[model samples]
Target: MVKRNIISVLDMKDDMPQLVELAEKLKKERGNHGEPLRGKTLAMIFEKPSTRTKISFDVAMSELGGHPLYLSARDMQLDHGETVEDTARVMSRFVHGIMYRAFDYKMMDRLGDSATVPVISGLDNLEHPCQALADMLTIKEHLGSFKGKKLVYLGDGNNVCNSLLYACAIMGVDMIACCPAVRMPNAEIMLGAARIADQNGSKILASHEPLEACVDADILYTDTWVSMGDSTSEEVAVKIFKKYQINQELLDIAKPDCIVMHCLPCHRGQEITDDVIEGPHSVVFDEAENRLHAQKAILLTLLK
Candidate 1:
C-alpha cells in the first residue's frame, strides 16, 4: 500500500499533479464537498505554536467531513517519555490519518514508519512541503504558470527556503537563495535540488550576498531568522542574520513589481521590513490563505 504522508519535498512528485487538480477542485467546491472525509478522523499533534497550520488543518478536515483531534506535545504521553512510534501505532488504530508538526524531522519519520494508516507531516524542522505547495499555487495563480519564472529567496536558508528550492526545481522555476554562508541550505538538499533543476530546466543557485540573488528576480521571499525551536534571544537572531534581511534596498534590485512573500509569523524587522511586506507587491497573506486550499488537495491525493 502506498503511504499517504508528506515528509519532505524529495521523493514527493508522484502525487503532485493529482494534488494540484484537487486544489483546483477544492477551490470550486469550497461551499460543498463537505463529506469527502466523512466518518474519518485526523489526529493533529503539535509540538510547536502555530496559527496557520493548526487552524488550516482543523478547518480543512472538518470542511472535508472529517474530525480533527488536536493535541500538543505537553498534553500527550510525549511528555511522559512515550515514543513517537508507539504514538503512531496507537493513533493509527483510532484515526484514519495523522498530522504532526514537530521540531525534529526524525520524529515524524519514526511515526510514519509505525503507522498502519496514513501519516502526514504537518511540519518538521527541515522541510515544509505543504507550505511550498501553497506558495506554488499562489505563484501559479498570479503568474499563470511556473515555467521559467525567476524566483528569489532572501533570508536564512531554513525549512521554507529548502521547500522553495524543491518546488521551484520541480516546476521549472529558476531560484536563487540569498543567505549568509552559515545559514545556507544543507549540501545534500542543495545537490538534490540542483539535480532536479538540471532535469527540469530550472536552477538552484546560492550566494552570500542578497543583491546577487535578487538580480532579475521575479519573486522575493523570506522567512524568520530564528524559528520555533531556536533560542528566543533577539540579539543572537539579529547578529546571526544581519546580512540576510530583505529591506527596501534589496527590493529595488528586483523587478519593479516583483512579488514579496513570507511564510507568516514573521519577525518583521529581522527578515523583512514593514514596507516591503505590506507593500503593493506583497502576496504573503494570499500565500497563507492558499495553505488551506493546498493542504486540502494534499489530503485528498494522499488519503482520500
Candidate 2:
C-alpha cells in the first residue's frame, strides 16, 4: 500500500471537503469516539516550539487509541549531524506515522520523501496544512457554508496565511491577503491558489489597504507579525504592520456577523487588538479547538 504525506494544503485539495465533513463528525463524537487507531503509534518531531500544534496532535492521537511519542530536535541525533532522511527512515520503522514541525521547509520535504509511513506536517516555514484544515472546519461550523464568504487575512502572510490561501480556494471561499508588500505570501503559492480558486469559482486576492480588504468580509484573520526563526526585529515589524491590525475600525467595515481568527500565541497589541480578539466577533478559541478534530481526521485518513 502507498503512504500519504500532507506537505502542503494543495496536496489535500481533492480530499478537503470530505476531510472537513469527517472532522465535523469527529468533533461531534468527542468523548464517545471509538478507537480507530488502536495499537498504532505516531512519532512527533519538533524543530520549533509549539502550543496548539503540539497539544492538538498529542490529544488527537491519544483519543484515537494511539501512542504519541514527542521528539525534540535538540534531543535527536539530527542535532549531531544525522540527516533528516536518516531520521525519517529510522522512525518509519518504529511508527505508524510521523508528524513533523520543522523550521525549514526543505528539511520537511526531505523527511516526507524518506518516511515510508504516512507523514503529516504539524507545521513548517512554508505551510501549516493541519491548521488550514482546522480553519476550514471552524468556518464551516460558524457560517454553515463556504460559498460567497469573504475572508480577509491581515498582517504578515506567513505559513498560516500561505496554507489558508489554498484551503480557502479549495473550499470555494474567496480570500484576500491584506499585508505590506514586503510581507506578502509566497508568489508561487498565491498563483497556485489562484488557479485552484478559479476552478472553484472563488477568487484569491491581495491588498495593501486593510480597510478596503475588510469591507463586507465574512471573516477577519491575523497572525503574529514576528514568527519564530524570523530575523525581523519586532520594532521594525510593528512599524510596517501596525496599520494592518485587526481592530474595531476594520471590524466595523466588515459584515456585522463577521468572525475574527488568529492562529494564536497572539501579540495582543500588534497584528490584532485586545478588544477585538476578546470581543463577540472572535471565534479564535473555537478555531483552536477544531485543531484536534481536524487532525483526528487527518490521522484516520493517513494512518488507518
Candidate 3:
C-alpha cells in the first residue's frame, strides 16, 4: 500500500468528513476504540517551539498505545548537517510514523517523499492541516452543518488560513478571507481551493473590510499576526493589523450567535482582545482540546 501523508488540507480532501466523524466519536468516547497502535512508535520533530502541538501529540500517541519520541531541532542532526530525506529514511526504520513541525514546507515534502511510513505535518509556513481538522470538528459540534454557515478568518493570511480555506472548500462551507490584499494567502492555494469550492457550491471570498466579511458569519476566526518563523517585528505587525483586531465591535457585525475561534498562543491585545477571547462566545479552548481527538483520528487513518 502507498504511504499516505497529511502535509496539507488538500491531502484530506475526500476523507475530511470521515476524519471529523471519527474525531467526534473519539471525543465523546475516548476509550471506545481499543489501542490500535500498540507497540508502535512515532517520532515527533519540532524545529520550532510549541505548547499544544507537542503535548497533544504526545498524549494522543500515549492514549492510542503508542510512544512518541520528542526530538527538537537541537537534538537532531538535521540542524547541524543531516538532510531531511536522510533523517526521514533513518527514522522510518525505527518509528511507525513521523510528525514534523518545521519552518520550511519542502522539508515536510522531502520527508514524505523519502520515508516509508506516514508523514504528518504538525505545522509549516505554507499550511496547517491538523489545526483545520480540529476547527472543522469544532464547527460541526456548534453549528450542526457547514451548508449555510460562513467562516470569516481575519488577520494575516498565513498557514492556518491557507489550511482553513482548503478545509472549508472540501466541507462545503462558505469562507471569507478577511485580510489586506497585500497579505493575501498563497496564490496557488487560493486557486486550488477556489476550484474545489466552485465544484462544491461553496463560495470562497477575499475581502479587505472586516465588516464586509463578518456580516452574517457563523464563525469568526483569527491567528497571530506574526507566526513562529516570521521575521516581522511584533511592533510592526501590530501596526499593520491594528484595524483587523477581532473585538466586540467586529463581533457585532457578525451573526448574533457567532462563535469566536483562535488557533492559540494568541497575542491577546493584538489580533484579538482579552475580553473577546475570555468571553462567552469564545470556543478557543474547545478548538485546542479537539486537537488531541482530531489528531488521533488522523493517526488511526494514516497508521492503522
Candidate 4:
C-alpha cells in the first residue's frame, strides 16, 4: 500500500490503478450512502486561492459525511509566526485528514512529516497529484485505457505537467511535453518519469517543437502560461508561450480523435484558444468534474 501522505504522484504510485477503479465505481454509484467518513473531520488549508480545488474537496468530504474546515492562511496563526510543524501537530489532533493548497512544496512536506493524519496535496508548486488522477480517469472514461495512448502537453511545464508525466508513465502512456526548453518541467521529475516509463513500457519526451510532440497524439493537454507565483513577467511568458498555444492548426496535427484538455482556470486565447477549448474535441469539463469523484476516492481511501 502507498503511504497516506500524498505529497507527490510517487505517493500514490503503487495504488494508481486501484484508486482510479475506486473513482470509477464511486462516480457510477454516486458514492457510499452509508457515509464512510461519518463524524470525521478534514482540515483544509489554502495558502493559494483556488476554485476547483477548494470546491471539490469540500463537497467530497461533505457527501461522505465528513466535516471540512476551510482555513485561509492569512487567518491562521501560522502566518503570525507559527511553524508548519506546529500547525500540523495542532491540526492533527482535531482532523482525520489534512489537505493543503500551497505555494511552497517544502512547507507541505514539513506538514506531512509532522501530521499523524493523512495529508493530501490539493496543489503545490511542484505537483498536483489529485488533478493527475482525475485527468487519467477522464482519459480512461473517454478512450478506455492509458495503454498505448500518447499525451502531448502544450505550454509551460508546471505542477500539472509534472504529475501528469508521472501518472502517464506509470500507466504505460507515452507522455510528451511541448514547450520551450526554458519553461520545461523539473529535470528530476522528468528523469524520474523516464525511469518509471522504462519499467512500464512507456515513453516520456520533453521537446521544444510543438508539432513534433503533438504528431499523432491521442491527448493534447495544456495549462496556464503564467503559473501562480511564476517569476516570469506576463509579457515574457506570453511572448515565449504564444507559439505553443493549442489552436485548431495544432489540434489538426494530432490524431482526429485526440481530446483537448486543460486543468482549468484557463486563460482563454492564451495557452489555449476559446474556439479550441469550447470545441467538440475538448474534454476539459469532464476533467473538472472528475476532480470531485477522483478526490472522493482519495478521501475515502485515505480516511475511511
Candidate 5:
C-alpha cells in the first residue's frame, strides 16, 4: 500500500527524516526479521556493476522477511533485445518491487512507468538513492546530528556527489564539492538542492580550491576519479584534478576530529592517500556497514 522512491535527489526533503528515524530503531533492534514482507518478492536488476548496492540490497531483503530475486541484465531476455518496458511489465506481474543499478536514469524511470509495482534506483549516472540513504545513516550515527556540520567532498562530481548534495541539504549539513568545473554535479541537481537547503537551513557550495572547502569541514569524502563507462582522458583528468586529492595536508585543515570517507574500491594514491584513509579518524567501514540497515528501512517503507 506504500508508494515508491526511485531517484536520490528529488524533493525528498521531508521523507528522509522519517526514514532515518525508522532505520535507527531497526538497527538497534537487530535480529528481529519482521514479517512485513513475508509474502512479497523484490527483483533486483544490475545493468551496471556494483558491490555495495548489490549485496546490501540482497541482504536487506532477506533480513526483512522478503524473498529477493537477484538477477543481472545479462541473465534475462533483455540480453536478446527485449524492451526494458516490456521486461518491467512482466517482472511487475511476479514481484512486489524492483531495484535497478543502471547506466541511465531513464531506464529506472521506464521500469517505473511500465511496472505496476514500485521500482528502486539502486544506482545510475545521475543518482544513487540507496547509497545516499546509507551515507545519511552513517553521518547521523557518528556526529549525533548533521545540523551545522560541514562536509567537504574532494573528487569527481559524479552520481555520489549529486545525491549527497540533496541529502546534506535536507539534513541541515553544509557541503563543499571541490572538483574541476567539467566534473561538477549536474546543474539541475544543484538548483533543486538549493531549494532543499533553503528549507532545511543548510547549504551547497562548489570551489576549485580544495583547501578552501576542506578548511573547517567535519567530514571529508571522495569517490573514484574515473567513473564506469568512462575510459578516456586519463592524462587530462590527472592534470585537471591533481590539486583536489585528499592528502594529509588537506585533512589537517579540516576540523581536528574530522572523519574521512570514500565509497570504495578506491584508488589509494589517486583520490586519497594511504595515511588519511587508514588513519584513526576514517569512518569508511561504518558507512559500509550502515548500507544494510538503511536499505532495510527502504524495503520496509516500500514493501511492508
Candidate 6:
C-alpha cells in the first residue's frame, strides 16, 4: 500500500468529510472504543514549542492504545546539522508514523518526502492541517452542517487561515479571509483554494474591510496577530490589527447565531477581546477539545 502523508489540507482531499464524520464518532465513543493501535508507536518531532498540538496528539495516541514518543529538535542531532531526510529515514524504521511540528514548511515537506511510513503535519510555517480538521469538526457540531454557512476570519493571514481556506473550500463552506492588504494569506494558496471552492459550489474571498466581511457570516474566526517566530513586533501588529479584533461590535455585524473561534494562545486585547471569547456565542473551548478527536481520526486513517 502507498503511504499517505498529510503535509497539507489538500492531501486529505475527498476524505475530509469522511474524516470529520469519523472524528464525530470517536468523540462520542471516547473511552468505550477498543484499542485499534495497541502495538503501534507514533514519533512526534517538535521544532517549535506548542501547547495544544503537543498535549492533543499525545492524549490522542494514548486514548487509541498507541504510544507517543516526544522528541525535541534541539535535543536531537538535527540541531547539530543532521538533515531532515536522514532523521525521517531513521525514525521511520522504528515508528509506525511520524508527526512533525516544524518552524519551516520546507523541512516538513522534506521529512514527508523521505519518510516510508505515514507522516502528519502537527503544524508548519505554511499550514496546520490538524487544527483545520478540528475546526471543521467543531463547525459541523455547532452549525449542524456546512451547506450554506459562511465563515469570516478577521486577523493576519497566518498558517491557521491558510488551512481554513482549504478546509472550508473542501467542505463547501464560503470563507472570507479579512485582513490588511499587507497581511493577506499566501497568494498561491488563496488562488488554489478559490479553484477548489468553485468546484465545491462555494467561494473563497479576500477582504480588507472586516465589517463588510462579517455581514451575515455564520462563523467568526480570528487568531493572534503576531504568531510564534513572527518577526513583526507586537506594538506594530496591534496598531495594524486593531480594527480587525473580534469584539462585541464585530460580532454584532455577523449573524445573530454566529459562533466565535480563536485558535489558542490568543492575545485577548489584540486579535480578540475578553468578553467575546467568554461570551455565550463563543465555542473556542469546544473547538479546542475537538483537536483530540480530529487528530485521532487522522491517525487511524493514516496508520491503521
lDDT of 1 by residue, 1-304 (tens): 6666687876466656556667867877897875878888888989988999999999998898888899888889962578777878888889888888988888888887888887777778888988988888888777788887898887678888888898888888999988877778877888888998899888889888786778777898888887878675878778878777888888888888688889988987788989878888899999998899998887776667
For candidate 5, the lDDT comes to 0.84
Off by over 4 Å in 2: none
Candidate 3, position 234, lDDT: 89
Better of 1 and 5 by lDDT: 5
Kindly report which residue pairs in candidate 4 clash with one another. none
Residue 42, candidate 4: alpha-carbon lDDT: 91
- Judge candidate 2 against the unseen true structure and give its global Cα lDDT, from 0 to 1: 0.94
How well is each residue in 128-192 modelled by candidate 5, as lDDT tens digits?
87778788888888888889999988878999999998889888899887888878888888888
Candidate 5: pairs in clash? none
Candidate 6 lDDT over residue span 1-304, tens digit each: 7999999999988899999999999999999768888899999999899999999999999999999999998889863678878988988899999999999999899999999999999999899999999999999999999979999999899999999999999999999999999999999999999999999999999999987999999999999899899999989998888899999988888899999998898878788889999999999999999999999999999888
Residue 261 in candidate 5 has what lDDT? 86
Clashing pairs in 1: none
Which regions of candidate 1 fall more than 4 Å away from where they truly are? none
Per-candidate TM vs. native? 0.95, 0.99, 0.98, 0.97, 0.95, 0.99
Better of 3 and 6 by TM-score: 6
Instruction: Show the colliding residue pairs in model 2.
Output: none
Global lDDT of each model? Answer: 0.83, 0.94, 0.92, 0.92, 0.84, 0.93
Off by over 4 Å in 4: 1-3
TM-score of predicted model 4? 0.97
Better of 3 and 5 by lDDT: 3
lDDT of 3 by residue, 9-110 (tens): 988998999999999998998876678888989899999889999999999998998899999888888836988778888899999999999889988888
Off by over 4 Å in 5: none
lDDT of 4 by residue, 241-298 (tens): 9889999998998999999999999999889999999999999999999999999999
How accurate locally is residue 194 in candidate 6, as Cα lDDT from 0 to 100?
99
